[model samples]
Target chain A: MKTSYHKLKNFINTPFGVILLVAAVVFGVEVLVMEFLFVFVPVIQASVPPIAFNFLDAVILTLAVSPALYFLIYQRIHADAEKLRKITESAQDAIIVMDNHGRVSFWNEAAETIFGYTKTEAIGKELHKLIAPEKSLNAFNHNFKGFQETGEGPILESVREVMALRKGGEEFPAELAVSALPINGTWHSVGIVRDITARKKRENLLRERERELTEVNEYLRNKEAKEQALLASLGEGMISTEIGGEIITINRVAEEMLGWKEAELVGKKLIEAIPAISETGNIIPPENRVCLNVTAGACVGPLTDDTSAFVKKNGESVPVAITTTPVIIGGKCSGAVIIFRDITNEKELEKTRRDLLSLASHQLRTPLSGTKWLIETLQREIHGTLTEKQGEYLTQIYKINERMTNLVHDMLGVLRMEGDINPAKIEPVSIQTLFGVITETLGNVAKEKNITLEISKTAESSIDTDSLLLRNILECLISNAINYSNEGGAVLVETKRDGADIVFSVKDSGIGIPADEQRQIFQRFYRATNAKTFDTKGTGLGLYIAATLAKKIGAKLTFESAEDAGTTFFLRLPASAK
Target chain B: MNHVLIVEDEDFLVRALKDNLVSEGHSVAVAMDGEAVFDELKKKKPNLILLDLLLPKKNGFDVLKEIRQSPEWQLIPVVILSNLGEDSEIKKALELGANDYFVKSQHPIQEVIEKVREYLEGKGSTKVGL
Candidate 1:
């Protein structure tokens, strides 16, 4: 949909185009009519006026009209020259017209302004001599001779640039276009000149800017490629995530660490990609996620506190020391980088250390036991009967020997717990039956002190516990009670169901631990001053070993006592379901 | 008197055990390691064997494996007396056809001798992998 206004705009944009088209059509029609007239006149000449008469008539007519017609044509030519002069004077480009004799006929105002010559000084003068450089004057004259013959030379037929000199003898760049016109049977050449010095300067500046831009682009590309190569070649696993904890980039080591391809984990939330589970096989709480902490702008170092393992895509756990740092950009946290390494080999080496310890302990025990047996068999008179004083000395030897044995046993037991061995086999266990076995095992020892061991239970139900470990726990508690109790004192073993747990208490009427020493009772080899004095023969590892074994079996062992008051040690273990 | 074979590496322990076993009225033979034990077994068959686990040459498990695999020696009673008291080790020894298992440090000479006498009388029994 073109409006009338748009049509007028098109016509104005190409103002000279329509005029040239109309001139071209009129010229074509005139040439055709001339050809037709020439042919018809030749054929009809006999019937028409005689050739000589016609020639005389034409000559007379031409002679009559010559002066008047010449005046009229001269007036018209002068008017057209005036019109061309006005047009050329207002144009931005310089216009110079020269006759075939190489003499300048006309110079427009622009030509005068450009060449520093007035029209009076330029007209009727040689054009080459006025404007051409001294060095180009000979070539310009040579080309001018050829141009007159054919009107087909470089300067006459087409646009071209030539060395041009100004009035001050200075040379500058210029754009020149030349065309030939036949006016009154002579070839006249016109040149349009545009000074291009400012255009050339601007073009050079643009080229310099483009070169600098290209070099800067190359430098940035190389820097980015070097950084990427460095990240890829690292041995420590590196994962860079967005500020929201979504994974954005992963290095080669990170792919191996997480057991996933980069495409599988990138753009996905880190927590979802590598689900960090605690050693207890439960998901770590969101607050504990190192990735999330870094995303919140907190710096984190390698975490060595709680054991955390990552769940791989294959559902296997890989222990790791995960640390993260925020990738800060302009004082704002844009993302975070997580670096980690697999700890499997470290874990294996730790196990090897434990196994080594066990091996050394095993070797140490054999000789220690041999010494014990040697001392015992000699004292018992199995090899020889001991005298009364020898018996007294042997008693001391037996006590010391027993203490060493207990210490070794306790040390080994603690090591086993540290090494995570001897797992509990949970089953229904009867407190009544355990009490029976304890009595049968330690009854004679209790009898030596006239201690009465009694058992009372409100209910008889088995608990979920390792039978042997529970037996050892009871044996430690009741024996400890009996040994610490006064002669003729009663030691009570009580058991009852308390909600989800079974509470078993070994209450002893004994010389109790001091209030000051109660706090230190659970520590290994710790002894109360009074107990150390009262019983010259105790390892003081009874409670420590009991407490440790209880923890190993997921039980709670607690106690309450006062100085010289009866102490009660309670063992609460989770009861089995019906 | 019943004949007993004692396979132990500890010099002091071997002396003490020999003394105790001699006093208990049982004839005793000694093997310093698993290889010696096998060689001694081929030379002379004892009524019972007290095999220590940690050996200098072949380990006790390999020796036990050999004993259980052989037709003539499979039925002979083997009592493992080891200082390595870990349950997994004990389980492995029993699974390899041990008649009984004992930690030397945990047992008195009298208890060990009593065990040796019981096995010598052909009364020894194992609860599993018999």
Candidate 2:
């Protein structure tokens, strides 16, 4: 019978059972009514005999039927109640029912899984006693009061990182989402909790990486500051320019050297900053802007070039030796970097070296000159008459002394020319007169070699220069041409004007300078290999002096030479002299 | 005859220079030190003063400076004769109103004489070598 009661409870919970019960009750009532009518009608006919048995009885039976209908409605109400109880117990979510007191009335499978408690153990216990840790047991009272007054509980619906105690008394980080439900006038909170320890660990690692990156950035910033400070404090002059020769930056040393404030020089073009001029009073273009003759038509300016001098803020010129290199970025000439030192001391040292050389040369030439004079005097019998053999001896002495004198003079010329001092007196000199005097002095040497020395004037010219120095330069060139010329070979000295310059050339139809030696022939103490082979008596300083002199005059000493094809040494002098 | 004064600390060179000048027909007086130059100058007016740059007691430049400051001796032409071939010193001397500058190493004794002769005979005498 108890089992039957349970089975009935189970059937009442089903949706189909409700339909079947209603049909059965209706059919049973119909049969019962039929039976009642049969019994009632026989009795009525006997008791009343006529009058058609019954309107009154019929009314009384209808009243009785209404009472039975009321009983049937009550039974349906009880059955619906049983179904609700069964559904509540079988639900997937925990549907706990508690009375006014905080007690666990029910527990479902999900509640057991989440809390690690069985229904038998959890039911009838206070909800806080089973779920809350000892520390949080008191919190439930406060939360319960809030629930009673508000008809709504403090339901945590957010995913919160908190520690939850398992049935085994172990605590773990968990995400708890809690919501309240009202059933039968009581409120209960259902919490969905999840562990999030791994997520927390990943967040911590990302935070650490950000800190490390910030530290690296700080370190780099400090390092950059230190390097920038070091560069700013460097003692030497530092200047950087753009490819167009515009000054980009300069340091304090450069400002002082230029005699300008830092503001004045930066961003100014190099040429505009200093309009430098050569010795002949002609402006020399900036080195970057200079073009070689062969490439003049197609050449563009270089980003970097070197120069020997610069003009200062006060318009005074100073000697400087600069080395410039291109600041290339991505294979393009972005700008230039120039490192220069004030070469005033270097210039002085150079001058001293030259002076010493000249002094030594002078000392040597003094003796040679004296020897020559004595030899000549003896040869001419100025001191006394000479015998034929004595005259021959005197002639040999004169020849040797003359050679020594020429070598010493050439050396002296080189030494003096190399000095930093400009030796020109810069007086107006007629080219014809100067040429006449020079050739006249060298004519005897040419005669001895039987070389024809011809001077031809392509243009009449005048130059303001030191006549004595000019004479020395001309003598050296003419002598070089004559000495190298073979017997009866013609040596031509030509003068012509090209644009604003006066050009002088000594052309010889004899042993020419070799191509290899020509480039270095102008170096101090450097002699052409061919010249050394042909004339062992010549000092190597002649061409060096000529080049120096040419530089002093703001002229270019250029030459065209070939082995055994003869050579032409040309001096391009400016029309104006300083 | 041009009257010349030779101021040199080197007695041997001064003697030789004086003798050479004397033989070339010039009246010559000599001062071995800068102090004696002023005193000698007052006694006899010279046509030219061949001044040495280095001297005892007072340098030649100072002596020249003193002479230039003085009214009586300022008209006498002074020529700087020195072995100090430095450009700055020469330029300073000239700018300080020295009449002429010549480096002894560059010119022989004969060339010196010729230069002196030419200067004495030219219009520059009044301003320089007179």
Candidate 3:
């Protein structure tokens, strides 16, 4: 009740309430005046009767209040309409009022700006025909027919997005909202239209970015799958680890070889998960592990070894030829990749080869030895004296036998060196003693060739190396030098200290190697063209055997030669062999 | 005269060795295989035994082991003359108490006689020739 009283009090203070109150007071005063005249003025009241007097008073009251009511209510309503017009004109959206006939009845300032028309030009124009695209006009006309008849249509009182034509005849996306209004019993539509071209551009750009992101994602997934397939298809057991030797991936071969699942080994330190053992059956420590060493950046080269074995999950050791390479990225060691193969079959094959070679050597040497003793017996003339012609024939046979013996020895030496079965036995070797032994071994050959063999020592140094291997290499070099020398040509076997290495060079003033054939001189069974022609009985395996032995003892065998001039072969050995 | 026993499978090598030893003024006994070695040893204790590794009946390693184990034959010098020239085989022969190890193809009959003379004269205990 209190709130209603307050509201009534507030309403009475309004202009319309004041006008109503004044009209009501004026009617009451007119009624009181009519009553006084009827009661006091007897002559007038008798001539005009009571009803006529009341009607006269009502006429005078109406005439007095008419102008006041019009002044107050009409002026207030006009002011309100003007305020609404100002608001509509100042809006950013185009505001238009369309009459029931579909013609623009009211055009605001925004509408003129949006439609490229002055208010006078737009006011009487058909709104849809003027602004709607040609494609949309049919639909607009169909909907407008219903609106014209009932002031209601499917598009009325709803927001919709439509293509609109700008002043320049360019179509742009726009948001439109229409509301119906009744003025003087005629339906008019108030429309709010907003240009949405910028919004639509933003949406299109967003969609384009989304599609690109999806494509990039697909490409990455494909690359990852390809890498996975490559890893899976590898024949060797492969393991990839992080910088700390933690296993990141293990391929199917590695899993099967190690008897461990990928999930079981991943994230575990490789050294701990699969222990490596040396040939002597001692566990290789973590710091000595090739993968860890590579990951720690301590090792730059790929470390490979065939004697190492990895202990499987079942405690069985499998011999493997393993190579561990660092995965370097941007000059930094990121991780390590270990590729290995089960070399058990290879080892067995090598053993078989070695056995076969050994057996062949023994079998061939037995018959050769028998022949050698028989020839020696004949040369010694134990049974009977030999004639001069017979002696010459025996000498020829001896030479051929000697050549056969040398060939057999060279072949055996090559087999031993190639197999790497005979490890170097390091000992202190006197350079002078080595030279003396080599010269003596080749002295007979040099004498037969009429070549002068000389041994000169610049610096007498004892080198720690395998005596047998060094002897074999020097003997080969000295013999080659002597055999290739021209008659009476001098061959020099010299040794000196070159830095921390022992340099043994055999210089011969004989047919030098051709420049093109020098590279292939160290290959097995390769004889220089001139050397072959000069000595048809040359085995062609001397330098190859020498090089193989040199390599076994950590020596570098190099040479410099000029065709028809001379060739000098240098064997450089570290003072303390590794 | 020092009696030298030639234990070899090859007829030519044995003949040459016997000739060389006999020419050097030593009586020669022949054992063509590992079994003949013991038969000859049982009949007469040779001053020195020339052993061949790859024998017909038994290998030289087992023959040498048995010779060294026997008190009567242990005193006799055993020399290995074999075509098997690998270091391991040589080492095995020497480790079995052979007085000397020589790869037969790598040594001439004269060198074998020289070695035999050195042993018979009590001038050499152990020697390896390849």
Candidate of highest DockQ? 3
**Residues B14-129 of candidate 3: C-alpha lDDT, one tens digit per residue:** 88887777767899899998888999998888999999988998988999999999988998998888888777787788888888887777666767778888999999766442
**Clashing residue pairs in candidate 1, if any?**
none
Score candidate 3 by DockQ. 0.43
Between candidates 2 and 3, the DockQ winner: 3
Ranking by TM-score: 3, 1, 2
The worst-scoring run of ten residues by lDDT in candidate 2 chain A lies at A290-299
**Cα lDDT, model 3, residue A214:** 94
Q: Across residues A252-368, which tens digit of lDDT does each residue of candidate 2 receive?
A: 777788788768877887667756555344567755333221122222333222335567889777665555566666866667766556777876787678667645753564455
lDDT string for model 2 (B51-101, tens) is 878788999889989889999889777888775554556776776678787
Clashing pairs in 2: A156-A178, B47-B130
For model 1, residues B3-108, the per-residue Cα lDDT tens digits are 7888989887887778888888888899998899877888788888888888999899999999999998898899898888776788899988898887777666
Q: Compute DockQ for each candidate against the true complex.
A: 0.25, 0.05, 0.43
Encode model 3's per-residue lDDT on A1-578: one tens digit a residue. Answer: 85466457656656667666667777777878777877777666667654446576596776688567758766888899899999998998889889888899988888777778788888888988888899999888888877765578788778999998877788888899998866544567999988788989999999999999999999999999999899999999999888888899999999999899999999998899999998889999988876667756554759877788999999999999889898888988888999999998888888898798779888988988888787777777776899999989987886677678778888887777787754688999877777766664567668778888888756666899998789888888887888888899999878888788888899999899999898999998999899888877688899998898888899999999999899999999888865
